[model samples]
Target: MNTPSPARWRPNRYQIVTISLALAIALAFSVFAFQDFRQGQLAFRVFNDEIEVLTTLANIQRHQALMFAQTLAWLDDPAAGKTEIEKQRTFLASQLRVLRPLVANEPEIEQRINNLQAALQEYDRLVESLGESPSPQARATARPQLIELLRRVDEALVKRAYDAQERSFVLDFGNLLRNQERARALLFGVSIAFILLVLFASGLYLRSERNTFNLRQRQIQELQAAVNDRTRALELAAGVSQRIAAIREQSQIVVEVVEQLKQTFNYYHAHIYLFDENRENLLMVGGTGEVGKTLLERGHKIPRGRGLVGRAAETSQPVLVPDTVADPAWLPNPLLPETRAEVAVPIVVGNRVLGVLDVQNNQVGSLSELDVLLISTVADQVGIALENIRSNQVVERLLQEYQQLIETSPAAIGILDAQTGVFVQANPQMLEMFELTPADVGQVGPIMLSPERQPDGRLSQEAAIEHITLALQQGKNTFEWVHHTRSGREFRAEIHLTPAPNREGRPMLNAIITDITARYEAEQQARRRAERETALNRLTQAIQGALSVEEALQITARELGQVLGRKPVLAALQSTLLSYDKEDQ
Candidate 1:
C-alpha cells in the first residue's frame, strides 16, 4: 500500500508565479476589450448627434423654399390683393431666418441662405416695377415681363439650393449611420469573443477543482483505512492486558483494570457496576480516574428498559451509545458530565447476570470491540466473587435465626445431671427470673433457690429438687408449683421434666418451666366474680318471677344492695323482656 504524503505540501514558488501570470494576462485582455467597446459606442453616439442636426436643417430649408415660391407667384398676378401678397412675404421671411441659423455651420446651408436673400430682392424689384407703370396697358405689359423674370430666378435658386442640401444630407448623415452600425457590429463580436474566452477559462478551472476534490477524497479514504488498522492493533493489545488484569475478585481491582486499559489506549472516564439480586437495575460499584468519586457518590442507577445500561442488561449484550441526546436509550448522567458516548457490557456468570460494566466519554463513538471483549472477561470473575459473597451471607443469616429462635422461647428450660441437681443450661428469661445473668446461672454446683420461699407458702428449693429427681427417676413427665422469684414476685408454673436417657440408661432431667403467673391471677379473679354472679343471678330470678313491683324491689334491695353495700333504686320496666336480667328472664 502506498503511504499518503504529509499535509504540509503547498503550491511551489514556480506554480505560484505561473498562476499569477495567468491572472494578470486575463485581466489585461479584459481591460483592453472593454476600452475598445466603450470607444466604439462613443463614435456611434457622435454620428447619431450629427444626423439629427442634419435632418432638422433639411426640413427648415425645404419649408423656406416653399414659402418663397408662394410669395413670387402672388406678386406676378396683376389682380393679386395686397393683403395676400403681404401674408406670403411675412411667412417667407420667417422661414428664411429660421433655416438660416439652424444650418449656419454648413457651407451648403450658408450658400442656400444667400440664394434665398437674392431671390427675395428680385421679387421686391418686380413688385416695385409693376407699381411704377401708370397706364393699365403699360401695367399689364410690364407685370407679365417682371413676373416671368422673378419666377424664373426664384425657382432656379430655391430648387438648386434644396438639391444641394438633400445631396449633402444623403452623403454626410447616411454615411455616418452606416459607419455607426458597422462599428456596433464589430464591438458586439469582440464582446462575444471575450465571453467565450471567460467561459473556456472557467471550464478549465472547474475541471481542475473536480480533479483536486477526487484526489483529496481518495487520500482521505486511504488515511482512514490505515488509521482503522492501527486502531485495531492497539485495541487488541490493550484488550489482552485488560483481560489479564480485570480477572480480580475485587470490584475496585476491576476498575483499576479499566484505568490501566484506558491509559494504554488513552480513553476518558471508565466505570463498572454489578447488578444486585434483581437484574432490573444497575448499581455503580467502581470507577477509575478523576470523576470516579463523583459517580460513586451520585449512585447513578439504570432501571430495566430505561437507558443504554438498561437496554444492555435486558438484551444480555453489549451496547454502544453514540449520542447522549439523540438516543432515546440514553439518560443524562451528571457524573459522566457532558458525556456523548458510552459502552456497557453485561457481567454475566453461568446463566445469571451479576451486573454491568461501563466505559464512558465526552466524545462520541469512543468504545471499540476490544473494550467490549476485555470488560466481558472481567465480568465473569466479578460475577463469581459476588455470588460467593451472597451465598456466605445467606448461610450466616440462617445460623443467626436458628440461634435467636432458641433464645426467644417463653419456656424456661434447663439441662441437669441425672444423679445430681447440677444446672447445665438455662434460657435468658429463666436466668432473669432467678435474678441471675447467663454468667451466674449455669454451674456444676448444687441447685439452689430462695430460702424464704419455703415459709412464704411457695415451693421450697428442696421440694422442687425432689420433684425434678423423682420425674427423672420414675419418668414422670410433668408437675405444677407456686414458685417465688428472687425479686419477691410469685409465679404459678407447670414444670415438664423428662428423662433424657443416655446409652447407659442413666438419664438427665430436661425440665421445661412455663410461667403461668397471668393465668393463675385470672383464675382467682374468676372464682370471686363467679360467686357474685351466682348471687346476682338468684336475685334477678326472684325479681323477674315476682308478680308485684314491691316484691321485685324488696328482693333486689335485700340480695344485691346488702351484699354490695350500695343502695338499690328500683324502676318499673315497661316489660319483662326489657328488664336487665340473666338470659331472657
Candidate 2:
C-alpha cells in the first residue's frame, strides 16, 4: 500500500572502500616500477659512457705505438722520419686534448691523461733534439727517452682499463634488461589483481541493487508519454558529452545543454547564465521558449549576490526553491508567472565560479534537491569541456608567438642537440654571423666550426664541450668562443647558452651569440701601445747615462728600431756637428 521511492540511488559504502584500497595499492606499485625504470636508464647511460672513454683512450695508445714504430723504422733517413713523426705527434696531442672533456668527471682519469700528455711532449722534444742527419750516438741517446715514453703510455692505459672495468661491473647495461622484465611482471600482476577486484565488486553491487531497481521500475510507469519524451532527450544528452570534448564553440555548447535539460526533465523553462569578462555580473547566454528569447534579446543580466542565480554563483552551491511564491529569495519575473518551483546549479571550474544553470517548473514542489544534483552533473561536464578548449587555444597561440619571436630576433641564435653535440637549428642571424648557409651548418659538429685552438691556448673543441656541459648541467653559461669561417677567417664571439628540453623531452642547448672581434682587437691594440710607451721611456733614461752623444744617439736609434718592430730609425749628424738629426728631418 506504500509508494516506493526512486531506489535511493547511491553507491554502497563497503564496495567504495574496497575499490579505493585496491586502487591505492595499484598506484603504489606503479610508482615503484617507474623508479626502477629510471634507475635502469641511468645504469645504461653510465655503461655507454664507460665504453666511450675506454675505446677513445685505447685508440690514442694504438696511434702512439704506431707512430713510435714508424719513426724508429725511418731513423736512418732523419728528414723523412722527422716530418712523419711531427705530423703524428700533432695528431696524438689533439687526441690527448680531447680526453680532457671526456674524463672531466673522473679526477683519476684526468690525472692519468695529464701525465700521458706531458710524456708525449717530452718525446717530441727528444725527437726534435735529434738533428736532420744524426750520428749513431745521438739516436742511441734519444732511444732511452723514447722507451721511457712508451712505458708511461703502457702504465696510463692499463690503469684506465682496470678502473673502467671495475665501474662497469657495478652498473652494467644488463641491469636495464632485467629491470624491464621486472616492470612487466609487476604490471601483469597488478592488472590481474585489479580485474579480480572489479569482478567481485560488480557481482555484489548487482545482487544488492536488483530488488530495489524492480520496485522503482513498477512505481514509475504511470505516464508512458512523458517516459518516451524523457528517454529521447537523455539519448541526445549522451551525445552532448562526446561533442563537448571535441567541439570548440562556447555558445553552441551551452545552447544544446539548456535545450536538453528543459526537454529531458519536463521543466517549463531553462537557461544558462555566464559571468561577464569582468565577472561582476552574470549574463544570460542561452534559454528555452519565447519568453526566454525576449529576455535574452533585451540582455538579461543578474548582478552578484542579487537573485537566486547570483546566490548560487557566489556560494558555488546549488539553490533549490519549492513554491517560489512563498520564498522572498526568489525574484519572480512576470514573464514566468507559472514558475512555482526553481533550481540553479553553479557551473564551477577549479575554485572559480564561471556561471549558473537555472531551471523552472509550473507546479509547486516539482523541483527538489534531486533535480539540483542532476543539473550540477551537467554543469560539471560543461565546465570540464570549456576548460579543455580554453587550454588548447592558449597553448596554440603561445607556440605561434614564440616561433615568430625566435625567427625575428636580431642576435645570432643556435640550437644544439644535447646528446650528440651537433648544431641542429641555426637562425638566419646565426648563419650570417658564421658566414655559412643553412645547408653548410646543418648536422655539423661544434668542432667543425671552430679553429684548431683558441687564442687562450686551449683546444677549441675541448673548450666548446666544457662550456656546453656547464650549461646543460648547471642551467646556464656565458663564455667567449673562437670560431672560423669556411675561408679561414677566425673571429671571437661572446656565447650565451641556456638549457631547455626539446619536443621529445630530451635536453637541448639554446645559444645567443654576439660578435666580439672588434672589442677584442681594440683591447690588443691598447696593450701594445702601452708596451711601446714603456720601452720608449726606458730607452730615454738609459741614453742619459751614455758617455758620448754619438754613442747615445746610436743606442737610441737601435732601441727605437727594435721597439717599433723592424722599422728603420736613422740618426744622421748635421754639419753643426753637435747633435744627430732624424733621417726624415
Candidate 3:
C-alpha cells in the first residue's frame, strides 16, 4: 500500500463560517472601540469647554455686580465727583485693561466692551453734574439726567452680556455637531475595513481545505469554547447595561414628579422640604435612608421664601447656593450639619412652579454645573409624579379612615363572599364574640365554628361546612344553634342572617350570631318555678277558707311549710319583719 494518501478533507460549512465570522467580528469590535475612545475624548473636551464657559459667566457676573456697587458709591461722594475721581477712574481703567486683552483678537467683542466703557463715561458725567449742584433742590434738577445715564449703562451691559451668551450657545452647538460627525465617519470607515477582512478570512478558510483530522478536532473544540465564553460575556454585559438603563429611567421619572425633592444627603440623614404645588408651601412626601428618616420624623419644614429651596420656589428661579454653611439665605438645618453646597431648581409647568427640586453635597465644590443641569432635567419628570403620589396617598388615607370606622362600630360587622363562603373582612367585636382572633378571621370558613370529624368516628369536619352553607342560602334570621367548642363547652347562639352586597355589586350574606343560651335557660327556670309557686299559693288559700281556723292553720302550716320551708304566721312573719327592719335600718 502506498502509504495511504493522507486524508484530504474539505472544511465543513460550520467551521468555515464560524471562524471567518468570529475573526471579522473581533476586528470590527477593535475598530469600533478605537472610534468610541476618540468619541469619548471629544465629549470630554466639550464638557471641559462648558465648564470653562460657566466659570467665565460666574466671573463676569461677580465683576459686574462689584462694578455697579462701586459706581453707586462714587456717585454719592461730593469730593470725588468735583475732583479727578482718581480711585474710581483707576479702578475702571484697571478692569478694562484686563477685559481688553481677553477680547483683543475678537474685534466684535472688543468693540462691544468699548461701547460699554463709553456708556460708563457718560454715566460718570451725569453723576458729577449732580454733585456740582449747590442745594438739594438744584441736585434734584439733575437727578432725572443721572437716572437716564445709569439706565443707558445698564442696557449696554445687559446687551453685551446677552451677546456673549448667544455666542457661547452657537459655539457649543457647532462643536457638538462636529464631534458627532467625526465619530460617525471614523466608525463607518472601520466597519468597512472589518467587513473586507472577514471576506479575506473566509476565502483563506475555503482554499486551505486539507485537514489533519486531530488538529481539526482540536480547533473545533477551541472554537466552541470561545463561542460559549463570548456568549456568556455578552449576556452579562447586556444584563448590566439593561439594569443601568432602568435605573437611569426611574431616577429621571422620580426627579420630575416629586416636589420639594426628597433626597438622601448622607448615610445617616436625608432632607425633605415642602415645595409649592402652585408656588405655595413646601410639602414633605417620602424619604428613607437612616438619616433621612430621622430628619422627617423630627418635622423639618421649609417655609415658602425662607431658605434657598424656599426662595427658589417662591421666586420661581433656580438657586445654586455655593456654601450652605456661609449663606444666610440658606436656612439652618440641624440635620444637615453644615451642608457645604446645595442647588434648588423650581419644577415648573407652564409658568407655574409646582415644586422645588433640591440636591445637597457635604463637600465644598462637590456639585458641578453639569449636576445642576442634570437635576433640572430630572425635576421636570419628578413634578408630576410627586403630585400623583400625594393625591393617591390622600385618597388612600380617606379610604383607610372609612374602613376603620366600619371595623370599630358597635354593630358586629363582617364582609363575606356568600358564593365562596369566604370572609373578606371581620370587625374586632365580631371576631371576639366568635372566640376568633384577627389571624383566624380571614382563614377560617363559616362552618369552621362547627365540630370537626376526628379519625376516631367523631362528626366529620366536612359536615359542619355543609350545614353552614345550607343555613346561609336559606337567609334565615334568628336561627338558634349550639356550638360545641374544642373544650366541649356548648354555646347556644341566636344567629340572624341577611343578604349583604359585595364590593363587585354581587350578593353576599352577613350572619350575626348572638349568644342567647344563658338567657334562654334562665327564662325557662324562672317559668317553671313560678308555676309551682302559683299551685302552692292556691292550695294554701283553699285550705284556710274551707276549714276551721285551728285545723286550717295546722294543715296550712304543715303542707305550705313543707313546700316553702317556713311557718306562715308567727316564726316566719317575725323573721320577715326583722329582716325588713334590718334592711331598712
Residue pair clashes in candidate 2: none
Give lDDT tens digits, candidate 2, residues 1-585: 988867776668986788687779668877986797688678767767775665456446545665665556555356565666666677777766766787788777777777777777777776777767877646533443454456456555534643665465445534554565565566556655555665577877454444444453444343334445444544455455555546677878888787878776768999899999999999999999898799899999999878899999999999998989888988888888898999989988645688999999999998876676567757866876666456445444534544565678787877777777767788888888777778865567556778888889998877878888898676578898888776778888898877644536666777778899999999999999998999889898879989987788667777877776444466232232343354426
Q: What shift in Å separates residue 452 of candidate 3 from its native position after superposition?
A: 99
Runs of candidate 2 exceeding 4 Å displacement = 1-270, 278-280, 287-300, 303-306, 314-317, 325-340, 348-352, 360-367, 370-401, 420-426, 435-448, 456-461, 486-489, 541-585
Give the range where candidate 2 is weakest over 10 consecutive residues by summed lDDT.
Answer: 571-580
Per-candidate RMSD, Å: 58.6, 26.6, 32.1
Alpha-carbon lDDT of model 2: 0.71
lDDT of 3 by residue, 427-451 (tens): 8777766667788755764555655
Error of 3 at 235 (Å): 34
Model 1: lDDT to the true structure: 0.59
Taking the tens digit of each residue's C-alpha lDDT, what string does model 1 give over 370-459?
Answer: 556556645544554455344334434533543454478665666566565656667776776666666764453224543445534765
User: Would you list the rank order by TM-score, best first?
Assistant: 2, 3, 1
lDDT order, best first, reads: 2, 1, 3
Kindly report the root-mean-square deviation of model 1 from the true structure over all alpha carbons: 58.6
Task: Please report, as a residue range, the 10-residue window in candidate 3 with the lowest summed lDDT.
Answer: 259-268
**What's the TM-score of each model vs. the native?**
0.27, 0.47, 0.31
Report the lDDT of model 2 for residue 233.
45
